[model samples]
Target: MVLQRMGSVKVASATLVAALAVVFALTLMKGTYSFGGFWSTEAHRNRSIDLQLFDAWSNPTLWYAPWLDAVGNVALFIPFGFLLVTIVAGRWRIPIVFSTLLGFLVSVGIEVAQYVYAIGYTDVDDVVCNTVGAFLGACFARILGYRGRGFVVTLFLVGALCVLAEMVLSVVF
Candidate 1:
């Protein structure tokens, strides 16, 4: 039993590192990360920030694009949450809380890097969605019985249904 747990931990750690590397490559090197022309005007031109919370929903013209982006952000951090919780804790309570907190901190770090390096839009919306994603991922890990809930699953189901309803409404009305 001890050896099995140790092996699992090692696997989780490796997978977590790989997942984070992919995340960094996707986010940090998104728009621009030129080494030679780091301070060029062109790099600064692409840099933008959106501080208004859920501002995307305000524009009807944006329609499904913003919603899709929100889902994508959540999906992106799900693996991080899952792996981190698996590696860090054997119980559900601490893993859920810490995974969410770490997710928020990591998302904030990514946003800060985006702002400084001018990689992409530093939007608070991403932070919010990413945090939620991490929380959900931790909950999902608990559900798989690998660590040892219906609550989070039900909540996510409801939320997903609501999103679907809104999408249909937007198209019909």
Candidate 2:
């Protein structure tokens, strides 16, 4: 019975991971889904990288922009870390570090793609925000306790709730 439950948890974890991948792709590469060529033919591309960390604060009128973007980026990857830790069996540090590194690499890749495809501009702030988000997410997973049947169940429930919230928000807006 225990083995059967574990197997089911593993299956659920895999499914959640797959769903995450799809959501991530859709969210990041939304511009690619438009009816256009493979590469954007825009004459101008934003390749400049803004190293100014607090520049987002300079705009007094849009004060919330920076805060929102940072928080949103972090919130975006929390699930990635949580789900990753739940699925992988290892020390807490392993998943935490792995998730952080993965988040950074993925963010960098997305920035590069955005620049190359002329879909969006690359920003160092985004990379920093994403990494921090992933780190927090990993910490959250650790807080929930790592690598157990209960943890797996909790992860699935939390993920489902998050998905439901997202769906509700999308429908409302």
**lDDT by residue (tens digit), candidate 1, 1-173:** 44234326566666566567656755775443332222333544467999999888888454786877789899978877877777776654588899999999999999999888777689999999999989988877766744232232233334444544443454355
Badly placed stretches (over 4 Å) of model 1 are: 1-7, 32-45, 60-62, 91-93, 147-173
Mark the 10 consecutive residues where model 2 has the least summed lDDT.
Answer: 35-44
Q: Name the runs in model 2 displaced over 4 angstroms.
A: 1-19, 32-48, 91-93, 147-173
lDDT of each: 0.69, 0.61
Residue range 1-173, candidate 2, lDDT tens digits: 55235424466476456546544543454443421222242422344556677577777445576777678677766666666665664644487788788878887887777667655556778778878877886677678663344544555556656665554454355
RMSD of each: 11.5, 6.7
For model 2, the local distance difference test gives 0.61
Superposed by TM-score, candidate 1 places the C-alpha of residue 18 at a distance from the truth, in angstroms, of 1.2
Candidate 1 yields a Cα-based lDDT of 0.69
